[model samples]
Target: MIDTLLILHLNDSHSRIFPFGPWTNDNKRFYPSVIRFAYITDSLKSLYPKHLFFHAGDYSSGDFPFNTSVGKIDLKILKLLGVSAIALGNHEFDAGPDSLYNALLSENIYLLSANMDTTSHPLKTRIRPYEIFNISSKKICVLGLTTTEFNDINPYQKPIKFKDPIQIAQIYQDTFNNLNCYLKIILSHLGAYVDTLLAKSTNYHLIIGGHSHTRIDTIWKVKNSNNDTTYIVQAYEHFKVVGKILWNLTNNKLIDYKLIDVLNSPNISQYMIDTLNNIKSQIYARFGNVYDDSIKSLDNPISNSPDSIGCLDIPTGNLVADAMRFQTNADFAVIETDVLVYPLYKGKVTSDDIFQVMPYGFDNQNAYNSRIYKITMKGSDMYNVLGFAQLIRGSVPIVQVSG
Candidate 1:
């Protein structure tokens, strides 16, 4: 029997729920909103009932709604969008295993991860290695592989060991081949580099990948040892672009494949628009107003940005350190650039914009109540702290300084 399947894929959408202009420097006027995405996907699914939606990972964090709501809003969006399956991203572990467990408990969608050693974690039984979909009596299997970088990105106190993703993918490919599945797809959060390696190693039909936030507009077709081709696709970051691929299967073999971009389509469903409106209202209620009229006009634009490799220098780091030093009148101040999320936009910068840069603090109820103690450290101790910061340069531990 010959059948067609439309696969809608997205990745590394770091909690950008609100609709905004495109991320790249293009003239595309499409406002990338979750509502728009849902509307488009729903319309397509109506036309193609044999379609599937998959998220490659990094679903939570990076936004106030994600942080404050603890992934509830994202889960709703995923469920509404009819996400068939999702791979775990390193950021999914940002809040530790307990929080991840709570998030998963609320989300009924299939969570696939083959390499994560959750034997000691709460999600051991909940997460499956792979999932099989029988559409039109045709067997379609999907395996998941998350990045090993979770070890570094997660909490130090709670260690979630990760096995080799490439090896796991190979093992699963053999297992699924024995099952005689028509199509085998690997939903991986192992980044593009590792996904490429996996494609070269395995004979899987497709690898939908995430991490590194690379925008691969075109599919990368890699041939395995047997000369069988494996397609790897990643749709940049954010919900600006949805990766669409049509798979034509005949007699249990994929005959033809076409990858296309489904930009923000204008046909928005009223239900989705209402859902988005409710989400916005809930977010505003939860966080309250960010700034008053007085603080709204504090639009002092700062010319500071981290390097392409995410290493911040004087302009970015020093400015933050100077602010800390000025606020507390400390002898010296050191601010880590890792804590800084998005950079200041070129236009007017309000208090809301600055808060978005550094939203996380010790206390969520009172973000400004992060404890700041003035400690009298010995000259040797101070020197050691600065020395340690220097050692972590070019990495997350890299800090900016002021005196």
Candidate 2:
């Protein structure tokens, strides 16, 4: 008898409620709206009834609508799309572990992280290390692993120890083997490089990865210690693509595998559009009525937001510098990349959008004030500043300049 299983995967979606694009050919030009994504996933479910939908993390903390609602909208959207299980990404802890726990409690979605020690965590019982899925009577085990890089970026309220993923994976593999699982899959948010490392160290059959947000069009095959092959795949970020992996098995034995693409799924249902519009209205309701006429009717996109671009020299960075130079009339303006918190979309720019982009606080007050200082500096000192700026690269504290 022949049995088939389909695995649909998403990674690093980053709370993109709506699609914004016309990206360069070198980049993924098309990104579907939330409704479009839901429609496509629902259609896939209809076509392939025995499918498992998994997200490899970083599904939150990019869009203003998702952030303002404290991830409530993101949760609802995921629930609507029918996500099976999700791994913890570094951004999940952006609002702290308590916020993460609370946000998770609102939904019934399964959270997975195999190597994170949750003894001191507030929601220890809620996060499971792994989960088993029975696809067409074939038992498949999925173990989750989050990047230790989360600890470096965000502050957790309690001691959440993250063990070595590779080490812990070996133990999980042994356990799953004893259960007679047909295949072992690792859903990971440890980025592409670490995913490769884990594939080499463990006897798992497939790894669905995120965090680096690279568009990998091909399956990465690596030979494990036992000389068995491990396959890895990651879709491009922000709902640009849905990865569909097909399994062809005969008598519970794997025979072949292939990847299918469901691309440019742009048609959205009226119901989803109405639901998203309601969410957007609520987000706009929270705006403080601070209007800047200069930015109103600004429908032309300066560039894709930093979240979409994922690199420096973005239009948002340049906008910050221009604002500083225009307001302060400084000889030169230099603003750090981190200061621009969100990306600019291709539609009408609103006051709420400005706050999302420039949100920062110190001592319970919004402290992002535009100020100018005049001082005499030696040419050598200015050279040092410029030299230090160049040294900062790749999501570091590089300065954007304008005069």
Candidate 3:
């Protein structure tokens, strides 16, 4: 029997340490799910003894608690979980390069992104396009690809450039061919469609994806010359779930694999449950009073309500958009309410509401003044830019109304 290589995958966890009532009611059930994930990591480390861990991206700038910690707390958790390499998601740049660099340094994890140019930033040396991991006798070639749309969302941080993902993958593929690695995988933060397209064209055996926060368990078999099977997997956001990929490798070739969902299970470990509960209690103790007073229920529920078109406040949107318009001195300002939907509630709102809503901060004065307008693009460009947003909606399925 050939030795199996296990690659533990986690993605799109937008800082959800505890379950929301709207999402899942059983903290009894949810806490164990998290604990199970932690236990799995420890078990794999002992069982495989040659296991690797990879994260797709979007580690920061989503939920209120996560943004409040400025990614520091998340990094601590990831380090504790033993993440080896991670790709850069678009939200990773929400704080700009300096903040990201500082945070990355604190965690000291391998940051990979083939398309990103960190030369101008302090992370130039630390942030590489690809990294190779030698586990036992197997050479696992891993390449990272970030969304090029960073140019559109973060223009102020000039000098940072993104290469075409497919093109970069080709470069890494050629390098892998020369080195003759046991397995070739792409840690892609380029969304699902691009991962599919790249898998079809390349000889890669797996494409671990992020940016969409998709919960895909089945393997995506791409059609190509090599007839090589490409496995695509993503864990739904908020640390609510953990994705497990078990690969049976025989003489450097994958014979079989399995992707398991660690979140929605009935059986969970006691140790992990206790750890999670302790963390939650600490959080409540620090902010419980403030959250209770400020976090008021809505007169009407926004999600799943007949009166609600979507989970956004028309008045709040107008207020925020107008603020952008005034600050930028532009003809118009457009804000996507979906982008700031965190620390959210189905009822009355408060100060914590604003923090959760605008955790990324309104620092892009240039975006306001630059006359940002939405233009419909061809399917490909649109897929590249807005694809992740749609994917997130699909995975979480939060209803929002727009006028």
Candidate 4:
């Protein structure tokens, strides 16, 4: 029997095409990453002749150019790169249904989501619960499961309801059992913990997970009811890594699998390099000469001391609370200072500085009805909330202060 090699997954690429670092002047450009991925795909196409590419969702929203384009450019890029299917992430609704509809116009890729109810919307037919692909004459069932927390993150997604992911996974598991496919893969945007639970509880052969930006370099094996093993894999955020899974199958059953990080040693193809360079030039030309002057440093430095009139290092939590109060017209506000901004210094502030400080915005009219208040809570409650706040701040860094 011939062994089939399947190159598996990608997750949470927040439209980051350029690599910026802690202290590096040269931008390594995600074009190389793209090129490398393409080269790998081409190699797999030739070697296996049966390749399945799947993304765990979050194709756009976050970076400037991709967000500004409203996922149009991303769709085109992904189409060109040959994405077979993708799960619908919360960020997919960032620009609302219209943008998603536009992005899904092409039928080349399958946009799967078992949880989202789009019957009332125009994109009803575009999103599917699952898709089946035949590779190497083997039937592979692929189902998509999105996070139920879409209600909290996506305010723009109206008339759409999110179902319980676990329930949806069970439904798909039943379907897969009936189908008796060679393999069953669940493309999930429900984060790693949920994915692990799904892998343990359900009959999925493999769980490709995303949303938490976790990079699982090793294949996590979980035992099924019959003592069979299921594989789970997830790549880190950004376009930094591409995950490859080599599945060893025997008698149409998955025996074992190995996960590889293709990004570490990418073989950049010429075509990909050329395409990346063109994109790089276009991006540089578009914004290269534009000068932004909103950011300016104050000559009079504010002290961190409570008594200081002008404090450059005001707590970000305090500033965000104040900004929220002012913006929402709320009588009182509360925020953590660490999230607001870093301390400002030197002669001139730039647009980048302002962006760094005020990355997230508040536009809630309802907040106006409420007053901003700082409450003194018990140590236990404080500890819980503070710990939660710290975790959130770590994942999504925010700067509340301007100066």
Candidate 5:
């Protein structure tokens, strides 16, 4: 067996494929993550021919690219980065299970979710509990487990059950023992706390984790049932950092590790530069250049505050409420302050800019946007809702009203 093994891990990189921040591309920024990852991966692969690259999960949403391509380009980008496999994230089923299944199949996306039932779900027989790799005379087994929260959040993924992760992990431990793998690792989407629980119970050497977007630069060590040490690591979200690991398999010791920032790289290959440039072009070609997708210019900014229309506040939420009222001709329109994510600022407003103002509440029918509901209630019930709004009892204030 080889003395050492190298690995790179990523998680919750929610489709922010391009340089993050303003509309313009800042090549200097560590973002435009695809290129940075490409440069980094190429450098590492050349030095160490045998290595494993993994993503803990959540490569699905959180960007225009995901909405535009229905998650095809997102998967393509990961495959382009030479990712061996990805753990199934909650957001993967955001567009409904059928769409997810088709996207994964069309892109040939490999996934792992040990606790999920493959037979009940549409992705029957495709995904596995773990993957075993024989690299450089050493066999390494990698098990995967997503969180139970996935079931709670994703209503569209029906008939799918999340089994107890600890139980599943132990079952996979037996698999590793019987297969005679030299090293065992758990690629998890169950946040840091649950990962700690797994480490305490099971005998995996390493756990690369995601969910909760934790940035664990330093190794978190835990002693397992047999009192063997298990180390856990997580890279921060959105391709900001990568968990780099080098373990000495022969001695079963962690030799080196770090959470590498994408910006702190040494060299840039010409191939990576061209690939980076092409990313913008592809996005533009697929979805019209958002920069030029102008809606209209606003003479003055309309604030999206959920305050009384006659008061000092700009009543930005009222405009949405007014629109809703006019469309349905409701007696009154009521909404929450949270619905308006960004203020409609005064400027040459584009479609892209408007999307940012209310960029949430995605449903299974459309990953792009959400639908507004119109309901009927008696005056007494209406009084209760209005009272609740005025009091702001919950974390989110249910303000904004229109006649």
Candidate 6:
């Protein structure tokens, strides 16, 4: 009964539906688009009869697709991709729990969070702690864990507490005492740092993960409670790459593994193409002619990159601050580097390009831009705000200022 299972894993997709980079000539390895992601993943599944398409979390928010549709598009993509399961990500609650409930109600994918007490929330029925699947007559189980540190911004209501992930892992593993699943997995959204701690504490066959966007190109094999191998793997953000590992279900050993750069596959899903074409009209109606004639150009690329955002006033932040300050006719304008995404490269720029830069913020309509508001701040208040911003999230500049 020795069977090898292909674990096709992805995480922190963050709604990057579009592909980036020609990068190289082979074209077999581009940054990857949602369309190409579907194709490549579908191909892989066909190659392996027994497989699981696991998404760690953050299936929503970031980039154009989620910005325009507020997760509907991503949900559709996930449904089409036939995701086996996904752990809940912090971004899923960016718009609050009610919004998350509505999004989940519209999709039928299994979402899990073992430590979250959503029992009183509207999402109670939609979310669960673990799920069991019968693959080739063998029962496989997957449990989930999400990060509790949401920076005090998630607007969590009462009774919806997120418990300790490490504690929950211990408790949940014990609950499956009689099940004896062929494989036990912990799908985690607690970031690599926490995931490392979890791997050391539990004895699961694998820990597919998300949250920190850490690229575990090589599986981080840890010795768990039983002194056996517990492999941890997390793919990088967007659909740019994925990790596929062939694991022996019989011996509980990793047979082989490889990291695939998601490239545009010619054999695309026509249904997805049609769905994309349908989404185009909705986008056009929301933000008219986004890719129309370039309305502007740039001399140099302005990037508010996360790689080096240690409270430094990045060029992208500087440019956005200037625009915001000018538009509001205010004494000063401040924006966060975190809100800014993708860089504004040197060349002709379109509305769509800027959308990639800050593809968040919504109002009555899902595709609306973040409304710029003027707030009167005294000298002392400004100083305090800047001070707090500097250390809010590990010495990163949470705000960009223009005066």
TM-score of every prediction relative to native: 0.82, 0.78, 0.74, 0.72, 0.78, 0.89
Candidate 2's TM-score reads: 0.78
Distance (Å) between predicted and true CA of 17, model 3?
3.1
Highest TM-score, which number?
A: 6
* Candidate 6: pairs in clash: none
Task: Indicate the worst ten consecutive residues by lDDT in candidate 3.
Answer: 21-30
RMSD of each: 4.5, 5.9, 7.4, 7.6, 5.2, 3.3
Q: For candidate 1, what is the lDDT? A: 0.71
**Candidate 6 lDDT tens digits, 319-396:** 889998888898888887778877776666767677667765554344455667787769888888788767666556
- Is candidate 2 or 6 superior in lDDT? 6
At residue 356, what lDDT does model 1 achieve? Answer: 53
**C-alpha RMSD between model 6 and the true structure:** 3.3
Q: After superposition, how far is residue 3 of candidate 6 from its true place, in Å?
A: 1.1
Model 3 TM-score relative to the real fold: 0.74
Candidate 4, run of 10 with poorest lDDT: 361-370
In model 4, what lDDT does residue 249 have? 50
Better model by TM-score, 1 or 3?
1
For model 1, residues 19-67, the per-residue Cα lDDT tens digits are: 4431235522245557667777777788877888899988876665676
Candidate 4 residue-wise lDDT at 160: 70
**Residue-by-residue lDDT tens digits, candidate 4, 182-212:** 7888899999988878777787778888988
Task: Flag regions of model 5 displaced more than 4 Å.
Answer: 22-30, 266-286, 291-367, 377-403
lDDT score, candidate 5: 0.75
Error of 6 at 204 (Å): 1.6
1-403 in candidate 2: lDDT tens per residue? 5566778889988777664443335433245456677777777788877778899988876665555665667878877787888887776665656667777887655579988875766666668888898876778888999888645444442356578889999999999999888878899999999988998888898899998886788778889867988888898687767777776644543444433343555467677778877776776566443322226545565642443534556577788788878887777777766556556555556554565464432111212222345566776887798787777664453767776
User: Which pairs of residues clash in candidate 1, taking residues 3 or more apart in a chain or in different chains?
Assistant: none
Q: Which stretches of candidate 1 lie over 4 Å from their true place?
A: 21-31, 251-264, 291-294, 297-317, 324-341, 346-352, 358-399
Give each model's whole-structure lDDT. 0.71, 0.70, 0.65, 0.64, 0.75, 0.76
